[model samples]
Target chain A: LEGCAPCGELAQRLAFLAEVDRLKSVLRASLLCDGSRRENSAEHSWHLALYALVMAPHARPAVEIGRVIRMLLIHDLVEIDTGDVPIHAQNGAAHHGTAQLQAEAEAAERIFGLLPAPQGVELRALWAEFEANETPDAVFAKSLDRAQPVMQNIASGGGTWAEYRVTYAQLVERVGLRIERGAPTLWHWLSESAQVYFTARTGG
Target chain B: LEGCAPCGELAQRLAFLAEVDRLKSVLRASLLCDGSRRENSAEHSWHLALYALVMAPHARPAVEIGRVIRMLLIHDLVEIDTGDVPIHAQNGAAHHGTAQLQAEAEAAERIFGLLPAPQGVELRALWAEFEANETPDAVFAKSLDRAQPVMQNIASGGGTWAEYRVTYAQLVERVGLRIERGAPTLWHWLSESAQVYFTARTGG
Candidate 1:
């Protein structure tokens, strides 16, 4: 609307694209696997979408890769309004869930509504499916969403885990269960490797 | 292999994900619409993927949205090794083509090979399909790729165009033809809107 009138699909798409650039500024608790800095929500969504593509063949029940990827890509648009809440935060997660959900519902409407018709509805639905994490696609997407940060934390030498003072028990219960449910094999491999890092820190 | 052993699909996927984080460091000529800094290839790919989802309906021949999204996401990845070569560079475009191609081919192998089997092959092929720009999906992906920079350049007040000393005729031929071929409606609107900016600077 600033650059030009929203005349049609292209205009609407451009406006949405411009608006979503705000996502780059929204930071998260997870560090980059490289230890460079904290990963923003936009980069997290991008990485998870790429992970969906790479891990699609391994998904149990053979989920729809396209749907999974779309869900992953759009899932965090709500965070644009609500801001990122680290799931591992012991005290924060309890109070944040309902408020975050309420805020995100409004956020979804405002953000996805930036697009033209059909796309707005379609993307809103994709975002909702990802939130529900009900379908096979959403489940696999959620698994990658959960798995990536664990990998990042481990790669960065107990990154967010150390920052949040996370214990192995908390991680296994909070993050590992969803991952195991959605991607058992990855959970198997990841949990074994992650325990090595967690155990070393806890013992030391 | 560096941080952890590449023992299985999960390990391989995690390793490959870490390696591709290097894509974030690979910068391109185009500035963000915000004029903060140049966009990285990873961010560029992510934006184009989002655009593929948003613009799928407008593609003239009706491309496979999944494939188009995949192509767009993987296309610039070869640049992680070869470095971004601006498509519209005044002098460099003519001389750099062959060398850039050879370098990108090697980069594609090294980067995509980091993934697990079948996935490595599949992604490599997707990257190639995007490079060739022969299929409907690839064509549309390329159009979006080309169109994005134009929008950036225009939005940033003749950004790369002013810096590189690009002209109206050069832009029409170099960037517009492919955009027109892939999405004529967008091309029509873009060209008309863009001409105002170019003409203002060109005094035509």
Candidate 2:
């Protein structure tokens, strides 16, 4: 068992495969608002990760695009444990503030544990860094994660936020965390757009 | 807008991606029960669809493997609305089976609604067939979906089931529906296995 790095890697890989199989059990996890055309979480990751690649150029220069990509890719994994807390319900008074965070922390431990010692440690560390939001990369990552949803919700007629009556100002303020901590330019755009968004009638 | 097939196809594509994202999310979903190695839902769907393809020779002769693959691909979308109703918690009293079913129905409608137009309708229909368990293809899809978890839970020392005291007999009996309703041969193996499982660990 000492330095069973290769064995750990094999085990982790096998374990990953098993989880992958299980995940297929529930692909297009739909919300309560719209019916039938619900998107699966898997699609969400791929699409967002791609978005990170495509939109990186438009991102604030100082922020690390790679880190933001990573953050967006894995941000929603916690939903697996906590279930996809609908966008509409995110700001509810349920006080689940850190509950999802805690759940993801635990899940990350289990998932990353399967990898070989070195890879597991590294991956887990990356996840933790993103979670901590202390580093510039983490800040950038968090901002992008929020940004993707903003675009998506808007495209879908403000998807869940509209359903939930979330004001544009509130969303910008909420998402402004990225700028306050890291990307000021992106924040500026978001802030201005949010004012307009709030001022406009509920079009969707 | 009425019989738009493209809408269903677009929804189908989105569902595929979303499911994978869900798996990645699940890998880090639960702290208490999740294993160390995480698997993205996308990986899960790809693998299961592959499973359906590889195991096609093993399925009942008459069942439509293509339809089964579709079922396996999208079965888990409901988790987005209901969250992953862990196997342990599924049988509990609060589920209010009827309400849960209704809620899932509504959520499915919303999630799938994002697709273009015609594509959405087809995907919705496929999802419905899987849920209803009326067709031969759906039966096998349902069967494979149910069967994948059993082996994993067993290998992982019964995983969440052990924590929840899920009975061997109950799982076996559950498979009977698949056999009688889905693939007869698939059920044949499950039915036999259930007897042994029940005998070894009798009376939960």
Candidate 3:
């Protein structure tokens, strides 16, 4: 299989597929809205791609939605090696320290490297763009990444927020601003919804 | 949330998202290659999107890979209501009977309709195109749809093929031809791999 001509490329792609299948086991802290079980990174990535597709019209400065969807689909493949670092967890963003960033960069190289050279490079660059979150496409992709869990939390009666004790103000400071930067309209609605949920939960 | 201006559109999109989240609970006959548990439709859709991204170069007639990836992401959202009809199940293709097709059509309308009008119409059309499997894009998307589970079965030591007692010939007739039509290179390698797995399993 290894020495075969064209089949060698197919073998490499299959090897990459087999390795990434482990992503189904990398569970995130967020629960499904139905409260069934924690969601895995694979399904979370899928849902975010759907988010990009359905929510594209709302992205600020507009974007090439195809690029946004692709970014969402591959953005989290690194979690297959590094495991999910829940955003609501204590010092979660801070946890992506220099060491953690270095580990993720290595994981991205190895995982995407399993493809033939052209695709491996293309996808690795897309993943890097997502980590940078600077381009309009990447910014919207990043917004959906943050927006999904907030939707889940509100639907699941404060899902991770309840579990991790994430306060409304903290959520606004941490998650809201990021989503607002890319999709202000979404943050507008989500902030209203989040306020309603928190006010009801605390009877304030 | 329902009747308010502007926010009305956002509400509809969020409704659509919340509804489709049920897709994660729709289990498929295919197992994760790791053999940990059965795969769900959401993750399966995700992996197929990844397949489109990685395998686009092999698509005959070439394809707009973004549209192909989008098709893969939403192709199985209908399974949310119709439930997964496993390809290797006895009379599996036959089981996509008039009744099932009607159910899936209705499911697509009700689900996609939950989005704001433009996105809803656009997506519903894409879903129908994938179902029709006529265009070059549709052909390639459908090919990856079939190829993914075969890859899973082979990697998991004849995963579903062993469980369902599917023969190599049946696999060729049922799955291989569709793959070959859109991706000859992929079918060439998959058929060779499938033959090896079946032959070794039977010691023939």
Query: Chain B alone: TM-score in each candidate?
Result: 0.94, 0.72, 0.94
Candidate 2 chain A lowest-lDDT run of ten: A27-36
For model 1, report DockQ: 0.58
The segments of candidate 1 whose C-alpha lies over 4 angstroms from its true place after superposition are: A3-6, A90-95, B1-6, B90-96
TM-score of chain A of each: 0.94, 0.73, 0.94
Q: How are the candidates ranked when ordered by lDDT, highest leading?
A: 3, 1, 2
Query: Per-residue error at A160 for model 1, in Å?
Result: 1.0
**Of the candidates numbered 1 and 3, which has the greater lDDT value?**
3
lDDT tens digits by residue: candidate 1, B3-72: 5553766677878887777677777898878777787787778888888888777896568888888887
Candidate 3: tens digits of C-alpha lDDT, residues A1-204: 345446677889888877888999999999998998999999999999999888877887669888888888889889888998888776446556798899899999999998899889999999999999899898899899999999998888889988877778889888899999999999998999899988988899
Question: What is the C-alpha lDDT profile of model 2 across B1-204, one tens digit per residue?
Answer: 123245444234334333334333433122211454434444444455544644565567778765566556566666656665554465534433787789878877876665544545666788888888777787777776665555455444455455566675556555456544554555554455445454666554
Q: Give residue A11's error in model 2 in angstroms.
A: 3.7
lDDT of 1: 0.82
All DockQ scores: 0.58, 0.07, 0.77
Off by over 4 Å in 2: A1-8, A20-36, A60-63, A86-98, A179-197, A202-204, B1-204
Which candidate number maximizes TM-score?
3
* Top-scoring candidate (DockQ): 3
TM-score of every candidate relative to the true structure: 0.93, 0.45, 0.96
- The parts of candidate 3 lying over 4 Å away from their true place are A1-6, A91-94, B1-6, B91-94
**Candidate 1 structure quality by residue, lDDT tens digits, A31-71:** 87779888878778888888888877679876988888888
TM-score of chain A of 2: 0.73
